[model samples]
Target: MGGGCCGTLVAVHLLRQHHPAHIDMIDERIPGRGLAYSTAWDDHLLNVPAVRMSVFGSEPMHFLEWLRTHGRPDASPDCFAPRKVFGSYLQDVLNDAVRAAAGTCRFRHHYSRAARLTYDGRVARIALVDGERIQADKVVLATGNPAPFSLEPAVPGCFHSPWEPGALTGFDPDADMLLVGAGLTAVDAFLALQAQGHRGVVHCVSRRGKLPHVHTLYRTLPDSFDAAGTGGARGLLRAIRLRARAAEREGYDWRAVVDSLRPVTNDIWCGLERCEQRRILRHLKTWWDIHRHRMAPEIGARVGAAVASGRLVVHAGRLMGVEPDGSRLRVGITLRSQAPLSLSVERMINCTGSDENYRRSANPLLRSLLESGRIRVGAIGRGLETDRHGALMESDGTASGWLFTLGPPRVGGLFETTAVPEIRKQAEALASYLFSIVREPEDVPVDYFLAAGI
Candidate 1:
């Protein structure tokens, strides 16, 4: 359904593996250009290095190799490529796959939003907003990230998502602006404002007021910690801290220690009890995110300079209130261990990252599925519940045979589901699973319909 990187990866794998008879992608945005990669700002470089960004995990150097032959002759594996370039790479990969399977596989893209979905045991039918309906043997919800949760007592001039096409437009260049959430999203908004010639002071507020760490040249270390031996969340934290310190003492960066856990993160996450998983989300998620999802070195340097110049201010606090003040907004916050503070700003944008709470999702298709008891919320309400193969779990706790998803939709079950490295593997495995059960070409009737987004 989606035409983003995740959906593109799945489609490519499906075509290459079995040349499925027919596949339809549903999305309004151009294929492969999801919110992350469609940015107009060239400053928005990918957080992961080129070497690790391949859509095919088995071909780890595919993306880097593609860059060298396509425009960037001097590209290196360690360099951080602009997300815009990555988007193009994904589009090219899908295009080539479609061309190669032209005779065997039929492909189409519906440039519209999926409004509703229904299944009658054997076939899944999707209703589009444009009064069109399609039936498919299988459906994959690859709708990337959802919009950020809306704030209560909504006020004018408050944008819930910075990725919206014109979210930052029309703001006064000299008026102060506030960004809610000081994670990677906030970093992106800050850099975007700079690129847009905004000279106003930008304030970022979050519970921890922590910024993402910067990437550095470091060798990946081999796995040494015993996750199974670690009893619970606290023990896991203690073990990681001890390992990080040991690595530092051994003249290696802590990043090496963190990277070493990549291969086994899902195993460790799934091994924990539900309560233990909740504990990690409540206490350690923010800290883990800052360290694990770092900014490119160049972006880090720019952010550091902004902080030094005092144009960007970070606060550890909770939003107290927000009220309109004529042409601006009066925002109140209770700073951590400090007195309450108030600021008047021309705009406020939500950069808290994606809203993983599918129960409250504004997407009509998800809403319909929830209301009809076709899907249930996942662990800790992070995302929809799914089995190991990304099959949606119905309200009664049985995995659906025809409804499936990947990438962000699988986050609750697969802790490391969003990145290309993890998602590509999922796509490949998912394609293989579908291929194993697919009918012969003569009997295939719309093999799958991919609904991309809200």
Candidate 2:
């Protein structure tokens, strides 16, 4: 039930597919409100367009159908709705999946941080922060994105982490807000502050001052992917580059480009050797993400309004340290100078997305897996390596039969794996892969009202 997008998507399909596996969802926060959706704040909005938030590609109108039935029939498909609403939508999908399952599955819920995971020859064990252990036939690492890495500074007042909710408790919006890294997280913090009635001067510091490009008008691309023939890093790149250039010449928009790339993303990712993947991350990742995963025009307009109205400001630099002055916080940032400037604020929130630096992670299970050479970081310094079947490869290059990673954690294998459309495919693929190992019962399609026995 954790709010992680990929985890919830997979769980929904797992139940819907009539797999006889008992399910257990473990996380530290609210089950349906993973980090993105957990925020009750009305200002933090989804970046994806509502039309694309369907549970699966097969059900293109799932979210649209949901909206029409739930009194939002005229809701603009291109608008970004509140994150809480998407959270609610996720819960609804889960409920529907449970109903569709017709008693084929059962689930256990745990509301605590997963401290570690240990595996013997046969079963995998999960260690929870609340001092509980869960053993299962299969363990999936759905640990979504983590907060961005903090800068090392000599001073004490530099607050580097964002996940600490207390950091924003009783925050004064009138104070100066010095933000580090001007990306999606920075935008989230900015909007959340406004929703909380914060009226402070916001200073967003980052290496580049460019913001994410908003999704333009949608233009469907030709479904021209050849997943079977693509192999080797260079081979994949050559194929994609030819198509991308063709896409541009054909006047394709962001949506079209992403749509065209969808079928071949995994194959392309796998074809790259460790070193090539790293090069892509160092150079192409930022550009790729901002262009590929675009923001809704409606939300983009709001962010633009914030910057235009003199309520927000952006700078290019790194945070050196942070200092606390009573209830107010003072942040030290090195901007355009050899020395650091002290900027004070009433609150600071980390919007830096997901933990990419693996060595600093304290999760016991991940640490154990890494040490045992069961999972190794790809050259990109972010994401775990996986094979075509979504099987995780440990550092020693052995694929675990009972362990798997479902979503963004497999970014090294599939670049665009976090969204619902992509995730639903993965969930179904994982199910099909697991079922294929031995003879399996026929699966009745979980469609039609009668199929759900409602």
Candidate 3:
């Protein structure tokens, strides 16, 4: 029911497979360009290399080939291209798929927000905020990530989400700004400010104040680490450390060892118990994120330059509060192992990352589904509960055949579902699964099947 990257890829795969079905892509914003690629800045390069960002699983060089055809013949497979360029490529791929479908399949794009969803014994009905309804035999929730957590209550000068269109607009270029988180989103904001030629000092605060690790040009190592032998998180950590040390001793970058873990991450995550998962989240998630979600080399260089020049200040602290101080904000911060301090900045931007808790979500569709018992929260309370194949689990302890989900909605079920490589694989698998269960269009009513005792 979304048209973001995950949704777009799924639709593209379905169409390319010539599935005899009409697909509906619903989204409030532009299709294909989700929050991640919606930025207009040229400096916002993709975190992942272009070679691994293909939508098709079998065609790994699809994105690179597209780049070569589109005036970027010099672009290498490992190049971190601008995100907007990728967005255009995705849009072009979708357009080409639509043309290839011809009269065999139909696609409808609804540029509207889905307010609520309800499923009867038959088809599911999606009610839009504009009072329109779409009935479908099967529905897939690919709603992507939620808005960043509102750490502090909304005030006049406090911005909760940095990605909100024009959120940084109209700010004085020379005025000091404070960012609440020091992650990728925070880096994006800092780059945006730099792009605008902002000369004022910028402060970024987080609990650890650790930016993402920089990506290096290195060959990936062979997958030899046995995840099954590693019992839990501690064992896995020990195994990884040993492998990294061995790699260092052999004159290979440690990142190669870490990159090799990508194939077995889900297996390792699944092996851990709920308590272990919680422990990892509480203690090691931040460290793991900084390493796993590294920044582009160019981006890292820019950030380093900014830091070296004293233009960007990063603080390891907890944001206690923020009060509006006429024409500015008084930010209360408590640094690690230090007393609280106050800083006045002309603007405060919240880049605290997505709020994974469903109960705290402001989306009406999620809330409605939760209240109706159509969907239940995940075991870790990070996202909706889904099975191994990304089918939604219901409140009555059964997986729904009519509803499926991918991307961030499956984060609890699959620890690494947010990235392009992971989401593209999921989309391909989902499309294959859907095609396997295909039935005649007239036989889509579940109630009829139940009545006949089929």
Candidate 4:
């Protein structure tokens, strides 16, 4: 019950295929922009190239074609356009799908938040924050990423999420600002501030202080890479290193080797045991993220320039504490293999990115479902438990035919579910599965409908 990219794309797929039913899309924010693309900053470009960002798997150049039609004749497959443009494109596609549905199918947009969900062996009931309830034969939970983790004893002049409107507003352009993470979100925050003419030092601290790798134009890997043969995390690392060395010998960049892993990442991840997954998360997740989730070339250049010019300082440390310091905040940090240090900053922003733990989520709907035992947390304690087809699993270990999910909610089951490439594929597959299971209202048990008290 979301209207972001995942929800919109799934809806488009279902509508285009003529799903004969009424679809209710719900979200408190705009349907297409979601949290990631709602920004007004033009400096924020997509991480992936345009050619690879299509919503349809069969048409890889769909996004490029859309760009060309929208006054961007010079746009090529490799160009990384502003994220807002992509958001606009998504809106256009959703509009077209809605128009195509005509009288055969109905699409409704609900500008509200989902508060709770309940199932009674047949139909599902969804309650909204406005005290309205809706019943459906099937439910798809596309609720996207959760908010950033909050620190205890909320400190003034500190922000937990940078994506909120006006979160970075009203700050002095010349005042030093501290960022709590050095990943893509941190990079986005740095660029957003720079775009606003912020000239003060941007101090970024993380466990490794490692930024995402820069994108490069390179050829794809050879067909003999054998990514599936890697036994576990250690074996995968060794194999990638070997491939990187061989690619260097052939005068090719190592990026091609990493990109080659994209098609088989889920396979490799599924082959590993739960302990192996935890090991990767503890030791190699950061390194893998930096390489796998590289930034756009242009954004990377700006970040490099900022660091080289002493305007951005990145440190490898852990945040010990943050206390009030009269007019500013005193941030305590402990660097690896070094003594603790303290810095007073005018403001601190938590660019630490999404919190994957569902148990700790503040969303009422998710908490309700978890507490009611309607859905069980994943084995890794990161997201909801789901089968291969995105069907949610109940606490008693049975797949829920009435409930499904995609995107970040399936990260624990599918290691690479967040990106566009993987998500679009999931959308298409889900739409196909739902279409196969379409049934008449009479086919569903009347008792199931009455169980929701609708």
Candidate 5:
């Protein structure tokens, strides 16, 4: 389990509901935060704004309250506060929830990493990196986003992923750095280098060379676009296409159409057949992305400034290959216009977005589950396929009752679930399910097995 947003929220909800089970949150929750909501770096800020990022629908001002209590004098209403502050808000909620509990369930935190997890009869055995294991009736896979996709092997002079601190370790500030894939993560890498006073040239490469667009705070947000009301995938596309055209005529811009479609994205996704989903993914995914997931206003400015300063270059191309060139690396890339370009750089970081291409995560756990026919991947390849109730279905068309998934792994199952709003909802639902099965002896029976001993 994590102490991040998803993990903390689940613990909070379970305590509030008085769920029966011992809860051990294994994360450096008291400090250091996490890779996402790091306060150590003041430059790091939350991607989401305060108004919309709430712990619960009923308590919309919970986070704002935390800010008032802890950071009131200095924090601005419109400020994209440092992400670490958000973590503090979450930790505060957890503390208060436990404080107010009449008969709080067994709750504690183990500040250690989960080395391995395996099923043990009706209970799951969790082994920690510090050589400890606990038996629990149910397990939640809430390990937030995993490490970023690697652009190259972990060889010297090649920075393969942004999140790994080792990549940035002892990196020469003046050496040229190449960033693979121009996306949000690439922006983060650029910002990290900027914050670190790295004055090297940052080259970002992608097929369209498209970076995330800025978020425009429109005065009047559009009403929800009900694609399901139209009935099917064709109808959904027709509705969006028509709305986009009308928005263009009204000078509303494409943003409105995309924003309006947010609430109904999952509906449209689930409504479509497998073939239709592929059609949309292949032909329309990119067009949809550049308009949808927008950047923070301040962050957007920094990215643009990097370009203007000639420190960052966005190249529209395909990476042909990269070879080690004594003390540096030569990257062969094919551009759309130019014949071809081969550049030598001290390092290359792959900010290529999520390895939703599941197989690519190269995760032993996921691969084991897949090969055992205990889990099935969805159309987008981002996560395990499950029903509305969140059953981990197998490739042989069977649902495994013992295993469940959480976080972005269910992106295909819920389109908006990657973000906080949707993730909180999922965590609540998952907690409810786990609580039911844990206390109700033999009810909701699962064919669970144990791995004997670790």
Candidate 6:
């Protein structure tokens, strides 16, 4: 029910497939732009290059071609363009598809948040926050990542998520601040603050004070590891380490070894038992993320400079306590094998990234669905449970006939579903399946579900 990149990509595929039916997208923000792409800061560059970030999987060079024609004439395939440009590209792609399907298909965008959803026999009814109701034969929950975890005490100076509009505003230029993570999100926050002329020292604290690795040109290695054949997480980790060492001995970068696993990561993840998966998430998820999701070279350089200059402090610690001071906040932290340390900061920003645990999500739509047993939490409590084809699974272990999802919501089933490469393939396959299911345009009627009682 989102109008973000996932939803937009799905709509584009449906239109391109010539689905002669009505399609509706619901979101309060600008269509084709979600939390990740809504940023206007140029320093928030895409971690992936233009060539690998296409909305259409079949058209690998689509984004690169678009960049070249749209004000980036000198853009190369490996160029990591500003994220805002990609947002505009998505908008243009949606617009082009809409124009192409002008007479054959009907499309509408609802500028509202989805509050509830109900399915009765054949039709699915979606209730909007503005009291609007719409019915369709199928509904796809393309809602991207959930918000960051809400910290306790609800202090005034604490920003729970840096993606919120004006989240970095209202802070003094010379006031020291603290970031509650040391991942890619934290790096983005630091860059945004720097762009805003925030000259105060920024303290970044996390369980492991390690930032994402930098991207570099490396040789593409052939597949040498059998991820599916690997016994478990430990076996997979050991194999990767061995392969990385071998590659290093051969004068190849370990990054290439990691990159080579892209095709088999999901296979390995799915092959593991739930307990094994839990073990990986508990101990190795952070390490995998730092390597899998890297920073742009330019971004890495800036962050390195900041760290070298001591303006950015990295603490491998956990936040012990936070109490409000008169004009600021007093934060307590405990580093590994170190004594307790305290700091007073003017602001604290939560950059821990998206909270994938849907069980604790406070979104009205998800709450409604969970309460009604329309959808269940995924294995290991990571994301929503979905079948291989992206169909949602109900509380009773039955796959939903009409409800489906893609992107971040399918994380538990497909560990690597969030990236553009994976999501584009999903959108395409889901669109084809949807097309096959509802072969005739008249299969879906215009009547709303009276049982919904909206």
Best by lDDT: 6
Quote model 5's TM-score. 0.88
Q: Candidate 3: global Cα-lDDT?
A: 0.86
**What would you estimate as the lDDT of candidate 6?**
0.88
TM-score of each: 0.96, 0.82, 0.96, 0.96, 0.88, 0.97
Clashing residue pairs in candidate 3, if any? none
Q: What is the lDDT of residue 141 in candidate 2?
A: 75
* Every model: Cα RMSD to truth: 2.9, 6.2, 3.3, 2.3, 3.8, 2.3
What is candidate 5's lDDT per residue for 198-254, written digit by digit as tens?
898999898888998887666334587766577444666688889889878887777
Candidate number of the best TM-score: 6
Residue lDDT tens for model 4, 85-170? 89898889889999999667778788898888887766678888988777777788988998888865568888887876666777
Which stretches of candidate 5 lie above 4 Å from their native place?
A: 27-34, 73-78, 152-154, 228-241, 248-253, 394-396, 441-454
Candidate 3: list runs displaced more than 4 Å: 445-454
> Which regions of candidate 2 are displaced past 4 Å?
1-3, 28-30, 153-162, 223-259, 320-349, 438-454
Lowest summed lDDT over 10 consecutive residues: which window, candidate 2? 443-452
Better model by TM-score: candidate 3 vs candidate 6: 6
lDDT tens digits, residue span 277-382, model 1: 9999999999999999999999999999988999999999998888899999999999997779999999889899988888889888788888898988886788
Q: What are the runs in model 1 whose C-alpha is more than 4 Å off? A: 441-454
Shift in Å, residue 363, candidate 1: 0.8
lDDT ranking of the models: 6, 1, 4, 3, 5, 2
